[model samples]
Target: MLTNINFSARQALSGVISFSTCTIMVLLALAFSTSAYATAVKQAPYEPDVAAYRTALFLANMTPVPWSQINDAWADPISNTTDSISGFYALAKRPGGSALVEQIKQALAGKDTQALYAVTTRVMATALLEELSRAHNGLEDGSAKAALLRATALYRAFEDGIRFLDRDGYRSTGLAWLDVNSAAGSSGVLGAGTLETDPEKFGAALSIISDYIATNYAPETFTARLEFNAAPENIAASGASIHLAFTLPPGGTIDDQDPFPMLVLNFEEGHGIDEADLPLVAYGDMLFDSPVIFGEVAQNLGVSCSTCHNRSDINRNFFIPGVSHQPGAADVDGGFFNPLFNDHRSDSLDTPSLRGIRLTGPYGRDGRFGSLRFFTRNVIVNEFGGAEPTPFMLDAILAYMREFDFLPNSKITTDGNLTDEASDAARRGEILFNTEYKNMNGQSCATCHDPSANFLDRRAHDIGTEPPAYKGALAQAFDTPTLLSTASSGPYFHDGSQPTLGAVVNWFDTRFSLGLSKDQLADLTEYVETVGGADEPYQAFDDVDTKFRLAFDELTTFATTLNILIPMKDAKHALIMINTVAPDLAADASTMKNLDAKPDVYRLAGLLNSVASHIKKDDWDAAQKSWNEFKTLQDAVAEGMF
Candidate 1:
């Protein structure tokens, strides 16, 4: 685990602290000239640049660590460090060694602090993935696979959080502590939380997450593990499935801070997913966080599902004009511009919460897509301009999505009723929300936004909010979003025109001519902001980590299988592979520089855009040219551009 300390490395000694880390090669030539050059001993499995970074970290720590002395010592079998960092760093001398070392050196000298942090984060992220690949033999590996995958997810979350906070832009604000919202805080829900000074809060933050993963999930396998069977997700619903809960560790409780917090994903009610098992959920989670999929092409631009919708929720930091209306809302179709994918509608949809989405549907603001599968495919390929996702990849994406859920706010019931613990205003709000009493004109809020059904009637409404000349589907009839998640995902409505609950209520009250006192309106807004409750907690699976590890393996396996089949000659597959591989390769840009591919990245993107035109016109030759250019770009990746 790499630490993100603002302080320089600890002074074990001033002696070794200033020794040049770049002296390994020169020292090796002089000290070991007479002795035979010892064969490179890889301490562990690694990709080329990973090996180089690992070595750089090791040598950077040890003052005056001469490669020649290490080489001479390693010549003796008794001096073997075959399973250690020093041994593994030695692999940098192999075919791709020098190049990766050079890349690391640049990062070491680079002026961009955010980029440097991203590089170390990438190393830890890849390291867990490598371990998972080795440990996951098959489905039968069970706990072994789940443990590894969970570790991978934690590492991914660590990497993602660091990228989220820093890569965009972070600075040492002149404050000891800055007021902030918790990750769980959304809209107006859970709004009060605190963070220390930026350096104190951020420094080594990645290491903290990484270490938790190491301590809990570092083991390759479990000895004896618990398993569970699916039960009725709810006694009220017949077909829905329950989350396979786990037995808690000795007094251990799931916390809100857990990135992949143990959510009781009762996805059985939805027919969208085939299995609601832990492993499947974990597999799905990994794919969503991975830039190797939809977020690939935008890797250099810092776009990932995690980059935008962090932890499957809203990204509070993203703010590109047209692409992002504010912090959390974004225009999905703004990712790329091309004829085939663009409808030229220019619709700006509010970013919906993927959490608890298994039950909330009539997908999208237009409620156009009948199934999540179609919605997912369209978002990646058509909206984000990701390469065409294969059917398997789509399924994996949906699997991850089905498990999303909102945390228990505990302030209100599922029906938007105030709990005994609710504030006086919230209680008054609950009364107004559930009341069928109409104004003199016979119009009632509950008639349209039904309380029993998560405050939505499963139909679109004008509500005086529609733009008469809007250019998208059902142009005037936008879907009614759930009031339950209103606290976490707003600026409201299709266009995110309203910034707060009070604003939304004000618009509705005026449109409906509901004459209300200021006190009444405040109470009503409070309930709407605080509504929505949690389902039953999971209490079954004792080995969630193992199950998750298995899922991670399955996800990786699927990606590998699908990606390897990409032939640059096939325009379609080539496009998909480009989206998948480019971002994936770019993920390590922190320490690994793809000098040759860097320029081609943009060229390939332009070529990809031109390809749609050729394909649409059935111009085989033009398409061929585009594909060939793509191939040239890909070749840089194959040759280890980083």
Candidate 2:
């Protein structure tokens, strides 16, 4: 059975939380304090469904509450349709859920944040009571068990708040839930041996939970409010550490970002690439992860190139409140991140993946820059307001990024034709995709997205996508995006509006009046999914800790480049290497499991700091001495640490 966890906030929050009293207090303090983005709205609603709750919480926890976006989120359930919640039954089926929807609509109409929050929590409390009553009254064991499970999901909405407000109540309530699940028992699979429900046991367990909710969460009793803080804090900052206190623009979250923090490098051999063989690549890897290359706020916040382009691919979860219209998209030139780069327009574009970047550019969404180096330099200096990158820095970063390869796909061959592995529907769709139509001005899908050239013509077109800010404004054209691996990369298009391949096909059909039949549309969708699909689109690291170790090892390997630089007496690039490695070592060491070995890790970092000091003074001998010491210490502890 599906739980209300799994890639959700609860799961993402698990690793970061220490469970200590001080930890809880600190987190709560951050939560309640006026966030950099949050406005006058003191609290967000306690929503029942996890998805709805996340969307609601995201909107409420903005600088000036995005009332428009919040209304759009609510607009889904306000209509007469019911949707699935964690593969359970429809949303309205939950106790008092329908009434809550209506209340949410009314609150949205009235523009009352407090009333919205109150109604949401009150309904959740009442719904829990109703479910408990249904479970007790139900004759069937299976039906009773279902009710208990639904009630458990509802209870989770208040768990964090309850943990904050009342510890004893939290403990008791948690135990009650476990007991109730045990009492309801399980129906064995394949109708083999079923454990019948115990009415006496069930009543005892149910009462503990029911009484707590009635006393604490009843409409009149419930007074607490929920406020979420998603801003990325400088976790690396410690007293005397290289990092400084920094804050995010808005809607920055480290929660979901933590799972896949490790930089994934692909090579011809796949995985194992010696840093010694590719010194520039190694240095570039460190530069990509290092925030020192960026300006003040970005450096302090630890925002680097890797933050948006995780593993040389799109960081789809990257979001900012005012700057982003949706997740996986941000207005890089917006006033929020850097006022100097603001284009004075709210034109938020989807963050395109950098995989196969060397092949895909003429860079930028509009294909504005012909040179990749120029584009990258502009990103550093113009977009994020970082200082002009040094020649070596640019060269190394370019070398690292050029190594990024597209995910391998078996369904499509070199020329982008569907292989034997592709479905018949996909093959049929390919014909339609290649066929030119008069409706599109004698053009076809293949006109822009040429199958022979990685599904792109290396050109930009208006395609009716750009919404002009003014009546006389010219429509902006976007570069033809490659279709490879787009199956996993969505919402599609420049603005991330189309959510699926089918949606994209439907959009084109309507926009150009193609008069494609429903079957033809389905075939076209299948073709795109086939071409875009990959066997393994993402890194296959087992867990977050494993990825953390990999990242630590990579940083250490990258640091070895200092060996060559120190001997050559190259102070500039050597200092860049030192600065990047030192802060990274300090930050990564905190997450290392071998706590006893951490001191040695810090000592190694201190050596880098020493080398940096010598480099600043241009004392090559002293820098080499510190380097030798660092290498000796690293050789001894590198195998055991992290």
Candidate 3:
């Protein structure tokens, strides 16, 4: 069964009550204010002509009112009615009025506090009468009808000379900034005879507005056509082929009006090629269940794949490193150089877009995995906890990743080659990267990092400097990050300490890594700069690359693209511990009692708080003290409680 969930303003208001009483009070005050609340009504500089307003109002008001009277009043704006009740009834019969009536009815039935508050403060008394007159004939609840009528009159009497706030305020405020423009040269405001005189233009304007609301405001709706069990059979029958379907937004069509294309980006592992299958890793437990640890790991150590690759669209930009770690907390390992030690800091761990990995270089951030096979194995062992994947699964996942092809950018290309002189410089830089130039030290870029293939030396070396102390294991030296997609992947360096490629080049040039003169360094940076986008060749999966397939899938999923990156063993261990230990802790007061038994609860709390304080201040010593204290407490609990 398919169920549609609709979220309304009333629901939003209700949910906020637990966390925000001030906002709730303000809304309540706005609803009850007698004066034309300045904030409640929003009006455009231009007003709709009387006729258009009347027509729109009529349609919005669901109540039945005399059409002839509305038409007559609209036709002669000069005619004034002193009787407020009569004027309200006349306006309440319109479409907008009907919508208000429905809104009130729904609110009352649901006991929506916000809606009731809005109606009491904003709805005109006469409008309430019109609704009551219609509802009286349809309902038998006398008390409810009377209550509604009384509430309406009470509001009307207090109205004074203030104008009723316009109902469109909410919509206008919510949608003011969307980049929607009128193509038909018609202003958004409806005026007298506009709809009849230029129906097409009016329709187009409405269509655009509707589309904007549908795309941005409406909740996403999805329907499950096939169950999870259907996947394995489908893949087995398809052999090497992969199938994909995109669920489009409602009211959206694949046409010129909508230029965006739907694509299923694919990433495959090396071993999968031999077996003609796709690889799948389960990353849900890491992402949702243990986000804290997963987040910590992603922030400090540089991940593979996404280290150099990136997506063209800003929204779909670089994968894990670009999105995930960019905004995370500071580097955990204090900027150490060792490959095994944590050293980076980032915000969110974003998944990289494998849109152009085929065109890019020797893979991985360190370029240690010269061949895709070696890259695949390293990822599984080091990052994914040494899980072996089935050959078919690896093949399918790899094939899917290869689907990401880059669209050419007009700004950079001329006659198929990069037009920017810097790009040509980058080509020269590539040569200097692999070979030593005159006036430069014997050390080439490839001396420390591989440039012909993976762009890494597959070996660690001391970069001759150490960073500040921090939590987590420390590395003796830092590993070199690749420059494959140096142009797009900013905030360069192993710890992402440098903000730009130029800054990185300058640092290494002056440092002990590769001392080079100004001209040599410039040429080197130029050559490496052109290595971005999906211009590189794709690596196919082969029999010999069996081990590489799993590694490739893990790296791709972990860094450049979305697949799965879970270590099943770690997940299983965590789950087992939680189920077994948490219950036992809950059952006996021994765990909680142990704190009182030895160190005492007060002391233990102080120790834990001290650790938390150090963590807050970014003090490694204080943090270590707290960790050690907590470990002792854990041991005490194990002996006494367990």
Top candidate by TM-score:
2
lDDT of each: 0.44, 0.68, 0.34
What is candidate 1's lDDT per residue for 342-412, written digit by digit as tens? 34344546566566676667788867777888888777776665677777567766877876666666776
Runs in model 2 deviating more than 4 A are: 1-246, 249-251, 254-273, 543-545
Model 2 clash number = 3
Candidate 1 residues lying further than 4 Å off, grouped into runs, are 1-279, 295-302, 334-339, 436-441, 470-475, 532-642
Who wins the lDDT comparison?
Answer: 2
How do these models rank on lDDT, best leading? 2, 1, 3
Query: If candidate 1 were superposed on the true structure by all CA atoms, what would the RMSD be?
Result: 25.7
In the range 343-370, model 2's lDDT, one tens digit per residue, is: 6566788888887788897899999998
1-642 per-residue lDDT for model 3 (tens digits): 113222222222223333233323433332222110011122112111222222223221211222332333233331212232332343445436655445544534554333333332233333434433333332333233343333233322222111112123224422321221121222236654331223343334334433433332221421221111111121213231111111111111111111112222332222333221223222311111111222212221222222223122112222221112332112222211112322233222222323444444355433444565445444433443223433533443344444444433332342223445435566666666677634345666667656444354545555634443565546445445444443544555544566666776787677744656788788766655554433332333345432223232232222211111112222333232222222222222222323344343334435544644554565656556654665576556533431
Ranking by TM-score: 2, 1, 3
- Candidate 2 weakest ten by summed lDDT: 231-240
Better of 2 and 3 by TM-score: 2
TM-score of 2: 0.63
What's the lDDT for residue 211 in model 3? 40
Clashing pairs in 2: 37-62, 37-63, 38-63
